[model samples]
Target: MKINVPFSIAIAVLSAIIALLGYFIENSLLNQIRSSLLQSAIILAGVALIIGVINMMRVHWVEMRGGKGNKIYHLTFFAGLILTLLLGGWFGMSNPNGYWLYEAVVVPVEASLMAIMAIFLTYLLTKIINRRKDFFSIVFLVTVLVGLLTSAPFLGQEIPFIATGNSIVKSLLHLVSNGAMRGILIGVALGSIATGLRVILGSDRPYGG
Candidate 1:
C-alpha cells in the first residue's frame, strides 16, 4: 500500500500549523511539544545508527572471515570502529587532555585517511584545469590565492585589500553555511511529514515489515 495524496496533504498542513503555532504562541504547550518531538527524533536516529553499526560489523565480519580484499583494510575498519567506541565511551566524550587514547588512536587514523586524499585531489585538480581552464581553473587559482593571503601575514601588511577580502570571504562563508543548513532543514521537515503520514496511514507498515 502507498500513502494517499489526501493523507500526505493533511500531514503537510498539520506540520505547517505546528510550525506556525510554535512561532506565534511560544506557550508551554508548544515548548513541550517541540522538546518531546526533538527528543523522540534523536532517540529514533540513535536507534537507526545502532542498526547501521551492527550492519557494518556484520558485513565486514563476513569479509574478514571469507578473506576478501586486503586484510589490512578490513582489520583497519574493524579496529577503528571498536577503538573509537571504547575510547569515547570509557574515557567520556571530552577525552580530557593527556588521556592519549583518542589522540593516539583516533587522530592518527583520521590523519592517515585525510592524507591519502591529497593524491586524489592532485589528480582531480589536474583534470579539472586541463578541461575547463577558462572558468574552473581561475576559480581554483583565486581560492588558493585568497587562502594564502588570509593565512599569511606578509600580504595583509602590504595589501589593505587583503583584510577587506578576508571580511568578504567570512561573510560569504557564513551565507553559504546558513543557506545550506536552512535548505537541509526544510528538506528534512518535508521528508519527516511524509514519513509521519505514511506511518499514520499504515502504508509504511513498520509492524508488518
Candidate 2:
C-alpha cells in the first residue's frame, strides 16, 4: 500500500513537538519522561546484549564440537568472556583490585590484535597509493603522514613545522569529519523517528511476528 502522507506528516510533527518539549522544558513531568525513556532504552540494550552473547556462545559451541581445530580458539574466547562477565557482575567492573585483569590482561591482548590491523592497513595504503599515482593519493599520504607526525608525543611539540602542518591538516580533517558526521546523524535520527512511529502506529509488530 502507498504511504499515507497525512499520517506521516502528523507523526513527524508529533515527534518534533515531543523532542522540542524535552529539549526546552526542565520540570518534574519532563524529568520523569526523560528518565523513563533512558531506563527503557538501557533495559532494551541489556536484553539485546544477552541475546547476542547467547547466540555467540551457541555458534561457537557448535563450531567447537563439529567444525575444526580452530574451534578450540572459539571455546577459549567464550570461556574468557563468561569469566569476565561473571567476575564483573559479582565484583563490579570498577573494582580496583580486579582492574589489573582488564588493564593488564585485556588491554595488551586487544591492543596487540588491533595493532596487527595497522600493518595490514599500511600494506593496503601502499598498494592503493602505488596504483592511484595521482593528486588524491599524494594528498591522502600527506594527510596520514602529517596526522601521525603530529600525534607522536616526542616529535609533536618539538618540531617547528609540525605545528603549522598539523593546524592545516586538522582544519581540513575537522571540516570533512564534522560535515559527514552531521549528515549521518540527520539520516539516523530520521530513520529512528520513522521506525518508532511505525511501531507506535501498529504498522510494525516485531513482538507479534
The TM-scores, one per candidate, come to: 0.54, 0.58
- Residues 17-96 of candidate 2 have per-residue lDDT tens digits of 55547767888887676667667768989999999989988888888888766976997888788777787787887896
lDDT tens readout by residue for model 1, 122-172: 677657767785875877766665655655556337345554555666566
User: How does model 2 fare in lDDT?
Assistant: 0.73
**Candidate 2 segments exceeding 4 Å error:** 1-21, 24-31, 89-100, 131-133, 147-209
Enumerate clash totals for all models, in the order shown: 0, 0
Alpha carbon deviation, residue 203, candidate 1 (Å): 14
Number of residue pairs clashing in candidate 2, backbone atoms closer than 3 angstroms, sequence gap of 3 or more or interchain: 0
Q: How accurate locally is residue 181 in candidate 1, as Cα lDDT from 0 to 100?
A: 90
Clashing pairs in 1: none
